[model samples]
Target: MNSNNDVIRKLHELTEADMSEAEFLQSVENNMIPMQQFFTYYRCAIMEIETKFRVLNEQFSLNGESNPIEFIQSRIKSYGSIFRKIMTNHIPRNVEAIERDINDIAGIRVVCSFVQDIYRLADCFLRQDDITLIEKKDYINNPKPNGYRSLHLIVAVPIFLENEKRLVKAEVQLRTIAMDFWASLEHKLRYKKDLPPYQLNLLADDLKKCADQSAEWDRRMQDIKNILESN
Candidate 1:
């Protein structure tokens, strides 16, 4: 279930005299259905991973331990976004190049209650024999230049097709609730193109402060949880 309303609206905005609006709309409608269907595998991969996390949460609950994971989110990149990425990166416009060059086409975000939980679930997830760890970037341990903090993992998981199994890559971002807050705000600010450089730098510095404070809070909260559990 995808909406072509956005595509149709965008195309109308860019309408030119030479192009037939009726023909162009029909062409877009024709093209969008297949593109939407092509990403079905990615969605399946997301569902598989989401299910794994949910199962893990339930197990922890059964054991009388706290469930670290708060919620999960998944997304498959839109065709327009993929096209822009290909153009920006100069990647060949083909299925092979798209898979080879774009690892974040399919993404999942896991928000946890504590910093320790982030590492704990990630370790457990990657330790599974079926999930192949392709790459990892620990921004939580080493914050990004813009003061963004999250653990990013690129893993290849097998998607069982009707004919065969296809391994697809999905980028997972694991972060604490505090980190998610800062990141959400940072992302909102980042897309505000009209902001002047000085203001942007100030915002970046402020975000750094917030990130540090959040990290400290994570440490103290985890310590408190540890103390309470020891009783």
Candidate 2:
């Protein structure tokens, strides 16, 4: 496939061919240039944000840690299916739109010791003139029906590449350590089955209640830590 249209046609042909989904997906992976561009685009997008905001890996990590591009490659390796679906099926609004969605499509969990850090970073990330906030979801304040709590933002950013430029959409998630733990567990359990609407509703209610309690606990622990540090 020379362009996006060719890519689509190739996808259709692959689907029709006498190969399993795994084989079809492997063929797509074998396309060296596009695959390389795909990951490179995502990395550059994140780097742009980091550069714009003066945010280092150390700033986001609780341990003040940093990771190399190889670490990022390892992480994306697990998300191969997500990339495949995007390339073959989800025809983006435009080339720029595709970049924005790809750049903003991933999630970064900011694990803070206190609840306030979540709000603080969200404010900092959203206030940037370069980063356009399309939507804000305060799940920590009004969480999902599941006991999930995280600050979510849908943001649009314009990326100027050498050959072309485009606006991309990204999803940002901010939450506390406790809330993050709950969310990770909740995602694992919920995706285990095809739950009915009523069951989903029940799970959501339980999650909300749990998130509320977790936030309360975070506040209390933060207060105690601050008091000890002060003394």
Candidate 3:
């Protein structure tokens, strides 16, 4: 079997799964290079946002205030995921359409120390002149049906290429460590394709319970933090 990076490389080299070697090579020549360039902006955007978060961290440290941000994770969506989304959305299956329609080619997940930190960091992050807030979804205030909790932001960041500056939209998910922990597990469970119906139902219920417990923990931690800050 091929390694993970090897598998991804193959898919990029071969745009559609149905293509043979000759077609794959031609498609690669036609589509892959431009797609690669587009993703470069995503990489730059991730770096730009990551740097902004690091600046926040540094400022908090100098103030002797506990940092709101615990850590950050960023990724460019896999070619397969992008392709599938294109097909599912009934949009043109080309790099241009994907670039024009897909807002989450890049993703950033910010894990914070407390629930309040999620809000505080998001507010500060958007205050920067370079970050244009496109959309905001407060899942913590209105948890998902399965008890998922997070603050989702769709922000456009400017990326400068050789001769042009372009704005790219990236999805940012801000949540407490507890919420992140729960989400990671929930994702794994939900994607377990082999799970039987009864087993999946039980797992779903259990995951919801775990989410509630994690949320309560976040609340208690925030309260303790408020007490300490008050003293």
| Best-fitting candidate, scored by lDDT | 3
How much is 30 displaced in model 2, in angstroms? Answer: 20
Candidate 1 lDDT, 69-182, residue by residue in tens: 998988877655565565557777656677788998899999999888889899989998889999999998898877788999999998897897988889999998888988
TM-score of 1: 0.83
**For each candidate, what TM-score against the reference?**
0.83, 0.59, 0.85
Count clashes in each candidate, considering only residues at least 3 apart in sequence or on different chains.
0, 9, 0
What stretches of model 2 exceed 4 Å from their correct place?
Answer: 1-39, 50-104, 194-210, 225-231
Q: What is the lDDT of candidate 3?
A: 0.81
What would the per-residue lDDT of candidate 2 be over residues 112-141, giving only the tens digit for each residue? 656666676667677777788888889877
Residue-wise lDDT of candidate 3 within 1-231, one digit each (tens)? 888755554545334344443432343323544555767889999998889888998898899988888889999876656654654576665566677788888999989898887888888999999899989999998999999999999999998888998898899999988999899988766655566779989988898899999999989988999999899
**Number of the candidate with higher lDDT, 1 or 2:** 1
Best by TM-score: 3
Per-residue lDDT value at 68 in model 3: 83
Q: Give lDDT: candidate 1, residue 124.
A: 88
Give the Cα error of residue 42 in candidate 1, in Å: 0.5
